[model samples]
Target: MNLLIAFLLTVLLMSGVWLWQRRSGRADWVDAFWAGSIGALAVFYAVFGDGAVEKRVLVALVAGTWSFRLTRHLAVRLAGHEQEDGRYQAMREHWGERAQFWLFVFFMGQALIAWLFSLPAWVVANDPSPAMNVWVILGVVVWFVSLAGESLADRQLSAFRRDPANRGKVCQVGLWRYSRHPNYFFEWLHWFSYPLIAMGAPFQWLAWLGPVLMLLFLYRVTGIPYTEKQSLKSRGDAYREYQRTTSAFIPWPPKD
Candidate 1:
């Protein structure tokens, strides 16, 4: 089946990525490849799925845009092949002598996750419905908001970090003023759009995996915990104060 082939291709490509990381000694590319692999699989499913051409094309465009934006954003950080991200550096330190082995496993896990996240796109592409419905429109709207908010958050953080005056300061500009991790929040919000888009499709329930899995990882596993730890380590009391005043995952007024 097309799904099986996509999954296999993802694993194959990520294996190559792992090898490249091993050679380059940079784990940052893992995130870029993860985003890119999902986009590739989404487009593949859209192009080859047995469904309405319009629906497939729409999903392809949407998913591709999401992937491109995220991947490019991540890629920018890798300019000059800068030092590895703190989180990954910490991971390498923790794993020590077995770092390469664990990183290989981590890269493969990302490949699997990329495929899993593509489920909504695959379902949407396979939907035979030719008409655009309220749900699809809603999904697009949510996608717009998520993309805009996330971009704003990233830009704000980048601008803050770029300023010599802001060094060692917690970013409290733009969206960051309200949410400690606005980018992560909006990234998580982006997953909801796929489920909305998948409404009424066969296997629509599978679409829920996007938002559900994203929330689980962002909240409990990969997103908040590491970022918070890194921030606390680097920013110390400033980050602690930000944490005290700002919502951890949602945009809201800061506490007094």
Candidate 2:
């Protein structure tokens, strides 16, 4: 029943956002709503679902913090945008006359992903364990590190972009110097927190899916591929050099 409610609520939220997207002709709002919806689900599960007070509160805070931060960041970045994201724009060109239908499908896809990603939070929130295990402690530490690292990456990129002189150049400062996509690495790393937080909880195996699937998406589907393509288009040899020297997803010392 709770699961059904979560799914229905997510669908309803996404449906409303889709209407807004249709009116504005910008699909980027899906990203903002994705983060917000996840946070909302965490709070809902924490407050209404079965769990020990401690675990429920912890899950809500941790997940809610991450979710709200991401949502606000995306919202600010996307404010007053009159066009869709480049990724979706490219899709629109490809789909042509069928673009509207396909875009609706895309919105639904994000809605589904939002629900799927909430699974770990759901598990962690319902752990019902009074004990503060070592795994939970480690999870909290990782969450803090990942959140800070992701924020640092965002700031570095934002600062680089703010400098008009750096136009058409790649960001290779701070965390960007080591990894081409430090933000993605930290985002993917964030997923591991749930399994650790729910270490002793039932269906801990399900929590593992967050990290695994997120890694796959970042590596293959939505993260590095499109961003690198855009960089290659704009920065050309500069980006290629960065790619040759920097790690793609992990934070490692640059090769050259």
Candidate 3:
């Protein structure tokens, strides 16, 4: 019943966004929606679920915090642009007249993916434990570290971008110096919190799905490949050099 409701709501939300994209032709809103939907589902689960008060509150706090940060960052990047994200723009070009139909499908898929990723949050929020425990504290700690690390990486990259003199140069400052995608690494690490948070809950093992799927997505699907392709195109030899010296996902000192 709850699953049905969440899916229906997600589909509805995506449908509305698709209509808006049709009218405005800006598909960048999808990223914000994806982030916002995950937050919404976490809050929904926290409020309506029969979980222990401690578990519910903690899950909501962690999920909601991540959602807020990610969506806000995407919103700012999306602001003042009628242009769709480059990936979506490429899809538009490829699909031609069929773009709208395929994009509708894409948007709907995003909603499902968002919900799927929230399974750990759902389990945590539905836990019946009466008091906070070590697992809960550990989850919170991991969430904090992941969020802080990702946030710092974003800020450093943003600051680098804001400097006109840095244009065409690859970012090697701060976290970027250590990993080619510190932001992605931290984002992947965020999933580990849920397994810890959902400890002892029914289907707690399901929590592993989030991190595994995210790593696959980041490594092969929607993440590093496309990003590196674009970076290579833009920064040319600089990004290649950075790629050579920096760890691809994990943070470590740059290779000499």
Candidate 4:
């Protein structure tokens, strides 16, 4: 319960900050700050968690690596980009004249979701286990693979975007050729690694909810649906053709 409270408070505080920044027309700063804040929280958990050294250290290392990689990737993507994310922009519209209220809800909501997603790590760190075992080894391997796959997918997409010859064309090379949202797919896979580490710990099975929620969000809610709609609007026929040939979330050989 204490952990849940801590997560809620963190979310509320971050949401308030986001609302303030959005009202002040500082969305870029808000996004960057949120990324940095996530990295900082991983550090905080590492230093302050009252657990065995091995568990704390492992949680810190894996969480920090994931946070840092994601933050850096978003920073690069948003660099010199003036448009707000479509999801956020849609929220802004929904809020009408009270956009700040909705912005607060949106940002803070994600913070809470992030906290939930990270619960397994926190739970594992709270355990008294002193020795690394097979589960730990498996978790580490999954984390490494997921992290590498997601990062590589992002890099491939970014490189495609940067090529002048590929302007206005759908990216169908490298990882992008196999999965429409390879990065998101790998991110979801990464969460399962947490449960593998925390298995047998009290309430640890509940951690499955985190990844399940994330998968639903990506497939049915705020992720691929919105992004692909925007893509279709912008890319038209090219994106449609790519969609027909490419898998949505999972990586596989292209049908074509």
Candidate 5:
């Protein structure tokens, strides 16, 4: 029952967001709403699930904090009603005359994706275990490390962008110097925490979807390919050189 409602609510809200973006010409709003919807659905599950109070509450707080941080980050980028994200803009250009129709489809797809990703939170929130165990503790540790790493990556990128002298240059500062997409690596790492939290639950298998699907998306779909394409477009040879020397996903020393 709750799952059904979550799915319906996601589709409805994202449909509304589609209409809103259509009018504003800012498709990036969909990304913010998508992040928000997942968080909202995760919290909804955590609140309504019939699970141990401590576990449910912890899932709520952790998922909520992650959601809020991501949503706010995307929102800040959307401030001043700026142009659509380069990815979306490129998509629109590629889709051409049928862009609106495709965007509508894209928005609906995001709705489903958000609901799917929220399942980990649902599984964790509904864990029947009443006592803290190795899995839960491990999950929390993974979450902390991932959150800190991602935050640091974002800060490094933002600070790099802030310097006018760094304009048009690849961001090879802090974590960026190690991994070309350290933020993405950390985001993927964060998903594993959910499976860890849900380790012993009967529905624990569902939690695996978060990390598995996220990796697929990051590697083959939206994460790396688009960002790299855009970077190459903007930075040309500089980004190509960065790509040649830096690890694409994992944090590691630059290739000598």
Candidate 6:
């Protein structure tokens, strides 16, 4: 409980600071800071928490890798970009003058969600089990596969965007040809790896909730749905045609 409280307080306080500093227009910095802080906390827990060295090492390795990659990706994408995230910009427009308050609430909510989503890593790291098992090996393999898939998807999209020939056309080459949101698909797969690694440990089943909640958010909430709507508005018939031929969340052979 203390560990959880510490995590929550740290996130909330940092979010509050970001909220207060919104006047400076540094939301991206706040996002990067949050990621860095989470990475630091993972190391703290791995080293000082009352878990076996092996479990701590595993959790630290997985969580740190994920956090670093995600943070780097976001930082690269948002660097030198002044536009607010579309989701947040929409909220601002909807809320008008009260958008600041809503933004604070939203940031706080994200902080809470981040901590909740990270609970699997926390629990797994703190578990007493010291034995290496098949599940751990499987989890590592899944993590690598998901990481590679997501990286490839990001690269493919970046390359498509960079090519003038592909301007205004939907990306349908490489991984994007199969899944519209290959990055999101691999992200979901990555979470599943957590439960696999932590199987048989206490509260391990609860770890499954992380992936489910993530998929729900991605599919029904603020992920694919909003992004797709924006894409349809921007790309129109091209995006619609791509949608008809490509999977939304899963990677599979493109439809004929």
Question: All models: lDDT?
Answer: 0.90, 0.89, 0.90, 0.76, 0.90, 0.80
Q: Candidate 5 lDDT (Cα, whole model)? A: 0.90
- Candidate 5, residues 1-256, lDDT tens digits: the string is 9999999999999999989988999888888899999899988988899888878987887788888989998899788556787778988999999999999999999999999999999998888887778888998999999989998899889989989999899999899999999999999999998888878886999999999999999999999998998899999999989989999999999997
Clashes of 2: 0
**Once superposed on the true structure, which residue ranges of model 4 sit more than 4 Å away at CA?**
1-5, 23-39
The TM-score, computed over Cα atoms with residue i paired to residue i, of candidate 4 is 0.89
lDDT of 1 by residue, 148-256 (tens): 9998999999889899998888889889989999999999888888878878889999999998999999988989998899899999988988899999989999999
Colliding pairs, model 3 = none
Q: Report the C-alpha displacement of residue 37, candidate 2, in angstroms.
A: 0.9
Could you tell me which 10 consecutive residues in candidate 5 have the lowest summed lDDT? Answer: 78-87
Compared with the true structure, model 6 gives a TM-score of: 0.92
Which tens-of-lDDT digit does each residue in 102-189 have in candidate 4?
6676677667766666666676676566667888789889999999999899889988988999888888888898999999999888
Where model 3 places Cα greater than 4 Å from the true spot, the runs are: 80-82
lDDT computed for candidate 4: 0.76
Model 6 score (lDDT) = 0.80
- CA RMSD of all predictions: 1.2, 1.1, 1.0, 2.3, 1.2, 1.9
